[model samples]
Target: MTRAHGEVGDPPVGKYEEPATPEAAADRVEDVLKLLEGRWKLMILFQLFGGRVVRFSEFERAIPGISQKMLAQQLRQLERDGLVHRVVYAEVPPRVEYRLTAWGQSLCPALDGLLRWAATRGAPAEGVSDS
Candidate 1:
């Protein structure tokens, strides 16, 4: 059977290689998980997935219960991780906006899948309150 480009059964070519050991694979997984380890990161990414540039104050208003300080900190972390791009405009007020980078856009499919699974299972989607 022919495997799609990144499917598990696809053969590794070029720079890519199977992990030397299962422990090495686990470590790689841990590293990625560590990057995304936070309450706000996923939600922040979800918001950016709407394909529009978002501003600092916009995030504050969209996400309930998120403080200004926390939102700033999380956006910084995402930018450092190369997932989110921050554009600062030179102006009196210093306008700033955030959007997902190409690397970050790659995450949309996986996130969409997770959302679909949650819906099928009757679980609440993000931003939806059970109450």
Candidate 2:
């Protein structure tokens, strides 16, 4: 069988080459993990998952205990990573909103799986304990 480019079963082309070695694979994983290494990025992504565009104040309210500086910083990072879209509207008071990009929306399933795993494993295993 054959598949067309960008089809569901089609192999990745262009710069999407697979890692050549175990070390390279690990490096790739590390790179992704680094992109998502902070406490707030996933939460920010989760809030943006439901197709609702949120403003800065809304995000501040939704995520309790996050400072304005921190929220702004995280949002900037997410925007840099191409996972979030920031739209600014010119109005009397200046309005800005945030929504997930297509790349960000693509992470929904993986986030859902993580949520499920966390729900099922609420407590730490034998030798593990909260830090």
Candidate 3:
């Protein structure tokens, strides 16, 4: 059966029914959420949003109390998800910098909205207030 561009599956969701891509585009949102599911993803994105491309050590310092292993795992996941770009510079000690990808930057607005909502919604029942 013929399918239109940017459409997925047979019979389509409406007037369009293009074949799904090999990369599985349907799970993009879920994947993005999963990428952000970690404790440090949002914090990392926030740091990157400030227009600072930070070296590996600097990134670690920005995230208080985050374990080195967790940071490494989250950074690897972010890299795999195309949400962050890792640049390696050839120098003594081999410098590596991390910055958000375009897709990652797009998430800033949504994150901000979510933050605002949470601010008004208050903390969870079991949550402790910082103040």
RMSD of each: 11.9, 9.5, 12.1
Between candidates 2 and 3, name the one with more favorable TM-score: 2
Instruction: Pull out the clashing pairs in model 2.
Output: none
Q: Which residue pairs collide in model 3, if any? A: 7-18
TM per model?
0.73, 0.76, 0.66
Error of 2 at 54 (Å): 0.7
> Which rank order by TM-score, best down to worst?
2, 1, 3
TM-score of 3: 0.66
Per-residue lDDT for 1-131 in model 2, tens only? 22211211221235777999999999988987776778898889889997879999999999998999999988888777767777777675878788887777877998788788888776767787788
Residue 33, candidate 3: C-alpha displacement in angstroms:
1.7
What are the lDDT scores of the predictions, listed in order? 0.78, 0.78, 0.70
**Candidate 2 residue spans exceeding 4 A from truth:** 1-15, 118-131
Error of 3 at 31 (Å): 4.0
Q: What residue runs in model 1 are displaced by over 4 Å at the alpha carbon?
A: 1-15, 116-131
What TM-score does candidate 1 get on C-alpha atoms? 0.73
Give a tens-digit lDDT track for model 1, residues 2-38: 2211211211236757889999999977987777888
